[model samples]
Target: MTDAARDLISKAMVDAGDPVEFAAYAPSNIALSKYWGKRDRSRNLPLNSSLSISLAEWGSHTEVAPSESGIDQVSLNGEVLDMGTAFASKALKFADLFRAGRAQPLKITTRNTIPTAAGLASSASGFAALTRALCGSFSLSLSEAEMSLIARLGSGSATRSIWHGFVRWDKGRAEDGSDSFATPLDVTWPDFRIAIIPVDVGPKSHSSRDGMNHTVDTSPLFAAWPDQAEADCDFIEAMVREQNFTALGQRAEANALAMHATMQAARPAITYLTQDSWAILERLWAARKNGLEAYATMDAGANVKLIFEAQSQDDVTTLFPEAQVIVPFAG
Candidate 1:
């Protein structure tokens, strides 16, 4: 946490108007299928549908207690925040949105437990956790739907962190954005422990927020996104119900490719893949080509996370022996 974040959190603690302190951990999510598009920007509503798997080993921890003053602050990594950039992050945006003008400054403190930016959804978890914590501090009786809505304002995919395991963000029928909450399906934490070692956690080659925004405004392919997304969502739901790994992986691969497809169709295109990225991809392909059951998926970042049974950890590691592997476990 930075000094600014600390200051923000400190003020939140003492604020006469906002006295409650709230804390929560936001877990990292990997899209078996991704969410793209926007119904509303400030509300963080989606235009297209997407689904993801929440990882137990990675995410963020957040605490938002009462503020003493009329001020809010943020602190990260033991550094007092001198930069205002963190405020510009989606976390603050969602915090303010949920406050709904009764907003008091929260001294928000946060720490990342997962590999951020290395194709991990740490930001999604971070913002979602912040929104949940701030909302808690407000004495707000937030329903999961409302909380998901609040989290959405922080990041489109974040809505999933509110749940524990396999989550599906329903692109429901409300234009007011009330029906956008994610629904958790069956998930057993011990069954899904796949080690997700990160390759890089700095600036991603392409930002998800930016990519989704571009897909909405500039991509010709955006026309058909909603239909495809809805279908993928349904497919994933059934797969989870049946615990069908093949169906789940198939949907995941299609969803990931579709999310990437829009990036290529954007006005000025971009891809997060580096030589490191492709090398990992090629390795996964070679493994699969040789009749191995191994597979991998990516978001708008370069880290290539392998999807394998917890029991296959040793085998998966040996196959892509050089790359980091996250043994998947149920949430």
Candidate 2:
């Protein structure tokens, strides 16, 4: 860990009598403005601010407790994971931030409600929940903002996953990333909906982290992205607050396309959107021309997610029968 990271962790350290079971749940989120590049990889600081809407009831549940077997253990969705597995290794490494060379053995269990590594924000939810569980297990009294700062060490998008509904992560101007954290927006639109059109539900061809680094290093077009993305984030946040669905939908779709365009400009080009993904966008565009009110965004994977109001639910479902609709603010 970097000195900045270690210092932050040290400050948040608390003493608990004994490790007891602590569990937390965090909702998966879809970025509206998109977090495409990083300013600081060690701390997972973003190059530009981004906004997202949480997926209600579709996320991860994580539990942390002292290991009964006297050794570290990890499980995902009830399946015991080998210590060398990627997820297990990453989870344990994250735990090390709190362990700080201590010999405390922890049992970390995470169960994701959404498809893992399939374009949905599973890592975001996973890390957010783990951060919460770890804090609870250690009896730490940190605020959500503090937790968000810590969770960014796990995943950049995880900073936003600390809350439900609309959230924005500010790409703070601190060298140590101490000011970088996410906060929930004060607006709530109960009719807001998101629909997932899964193109490939398996693990992505490339991780978002690797893809981001490669694009930043090789994509000449990325020079223009940071500034444009910052402007888009501000605009999208305003639209969300004003409940302007039309403006929000348009800018969100444009921003997603712009992000992908930068990736296409990379040396050797990294294309996550498959032919089928384009087909969905083509169909969506055609429907939009005929007055269907919805916009699409994609991440580092092939699946497409559409943002629309409750009024367009029937039309969206009629157009894409396979789409899985989720009401973000539903009780």
Candidate achieving the largest TM-score: 2
Estimate every model's Cα lDDT from 0 to 1. Answer: 0.67, 0.91
Which stretch of 10 consecutive residues in model 1 shows the poorest summed lDDT? 1-10
Encode model 1's per-residue lDDT on 1-331: one tens digit a residue: 1222223333443443454777888787877767777876756667756667776657778888756766766777444454367553445555655454665666778887765434465667887788677767765555665666657756778888876677888876666565766877765545553444355667766567787787778889878877887888888778767777766766776777777777778898767656777777787778777765655667777777766666666677786555454444632
Q: What C-alpha lDDT does candidate 1 achieve relative to the native structure?
A: 0.67
Q: Encode model 2's per-residue lDDT on 1-331: one tens digit a residue.
A: 3445456667767554456799999999999999999988888888999999999899999999999899999999999999999999999999999888777899999999885434575789999999999988988878898889899999999999999999999999888888889999998899999999988876677899999999999999999999999999999999999999999999999999999999999997999999999999999999999999999999998999999999999999999998899989997
Q: Write down the TM-score for model 1.
A: 0.85
